[model samples]
Target: MDGRPMTFAKMLEETYTDGIAVLHRGKLIYERYFGALKPHKPHIGMSVTKSFTGVLAGILVTEGKIDPQAPVTDYVPELKASAFGDARVHEVMDMTTGLEYTEVYTDRNSHVWGLRRANGMAPIPPNYDGPTTIFDFLVAQKKQGEHGKAFAYKTVNTDVLAWICRRASGLTLSDLLSERIWTQIGAEEDAHYHVDRIGTESGGGGLSTTLRDLARFGETMRNHGRFNGRQIVPSSVVEDISRGGDPEKFKPAGYTTLPGASYRNQWWVTHNPHGAYMARGVHGQGIYVDPKAEMVIARYASHPVAGNAANDPVTLPAYMALAKALIAGG
Candidate 1:
């Protein structure tokens, strides 16, 4: 893809894709599975869960339960002494909150592992006595720099936002998601989130859903939040996320593959000609929506690498190529 030719099959193989589905104008065009994955099985969504949390927050905002301009402490006074104490709700939603936590997946010692351990995603060491629950882990975070100044891809930000959502709506993350999105989309199967010690859902990276349901959600976004004869997500929330955040803030993040891209409400906005945006997860899971071409791609993968850098080189170009082809003929 970078000054070289690659086939679609080669891209899928190289990225270690497990399953993928493509929809155009709300109709399934292609579907396939590989490796140990089956059509009805639910694969872990990784960070894609953050997008769901973000959308849920947006819904609460529209309901007048959450004020984007309000300080994080207003909702969760428990975080008043943490890094999010001084952060605004919008900053957390956009991931612009400056926190000391780092997310270098290659580094086993990175703060992300601690988060995993706290959120029940990773096993805790016998001697390790860190926070065993998501709330404890979040309350211990320290501020790194000025909030709302630059973008940082830290998972804790989403967790904090999830706490805010819960405080405002008086509902757990799982129930809020089910009531607001899953059932509204007429999901083919039940979706779930892994929970921490105290039964709090890991809103950052703990969701699991089938590939077809993922495509349904993707198509819902492409159609301005309407799916299955109903408006699942408010159009205004979709519009705000699709509009994107300031690229200047996102520039410092240095995502080489996503030039001129911005993270808004946990979704990555490409700002390309197609006005494409995506909900991405570690290890190649993603829901790519290209509004211009009316195409939605839902993919679940188990790439050997944990970051999108390993898959974007091949996948991004391939997606654009398919969009171009569809625009030309289909």
Candidate 2:
């Protein structure tokens, strides 16, 4: 893929993809499993969970339970003294907040590790006096720069949005997801979100689901949030997300793998001719949807690296090539 032609199977192997399901016109066209994954086994979704949280927030917004233009403190007053004190809900949802927290995964001292420990994804030392809960961790964050200025891929913003969604809807993340999405998608198996010490779902990146279920969710988004003969998510929300955010805001992030791409409602918009976008996670997990080609690809993987930069170069080209082939043959 770097220069020469690469086969689809070679791309999968090179990216360490565990499972993938491709859908065309709401029908299963290709599916495969590898590594230790099975058709029904739930795989860690990583930051892909942020997209789910975003959709849930959109649902709440459509119901008039949330006001995105309002300050973050309007829903969670406790964060009024934190970095989010001067931020708006929409800034957090779009990850354009100027928080001091750092999310470099390879840096052990990065603030993301603190979040992982607080969210029950990492080991906490017995003498650790840092924030032990996600809420506490969020409240301790400090401001770095002006909010709503540029895009920064921080998991904490998604958690903050999830917290706002809970406050506005009077429902926990897991319960809300089950009631609004999981149950409505006709999922074959139950999905779960890893929780913090006080049973709060790690809405940032804690979701796990079967490959097929992931594909279903992708198809739902592809169809403008309708699936299983019902409107699972409002068409307006999907349309807004599909329309995308400011690429200028997304450019400073320096994601060389995704030029001219924007982050909207936790999804990555390609701004390409195919009107393609994706919900992506660390270590290669993703749901790539090409609207013009009527294609959706849901994948779970375990790459040695934790960033999508490694996976994008290999997988993204293959996806686009396949989309072009589908359109040409049709």
Q: Report, for every candidate in turn, its global Cα lDDT versus the true structure.
A: 0.93, 0.95
Mind giving the per-residue lDDT tens digits that candidate 2 earns over 42-72? 9999999999999999999999999999999
Look at candidate 2 and tell me the lDDT of residue 246: 100
RMSD of each: 0.9, 0.7
RMSD of 2: 0.7
Pairs in clash, predicted candidate 1: none
* Candidate 2 off by > 4 Å: none
Pairs of colliding residues, candidate 2: none
- Backbone clashes for every candidate come to 0, 0
* Predicted model with the maximum lDDT: 2
Per-residue lDDT over 252-329 for candidate 1, one digit per residue giving the tens place of the 0 to 100 score: 999999999999999999999999999999999999999999999999999989999999999999999989988998
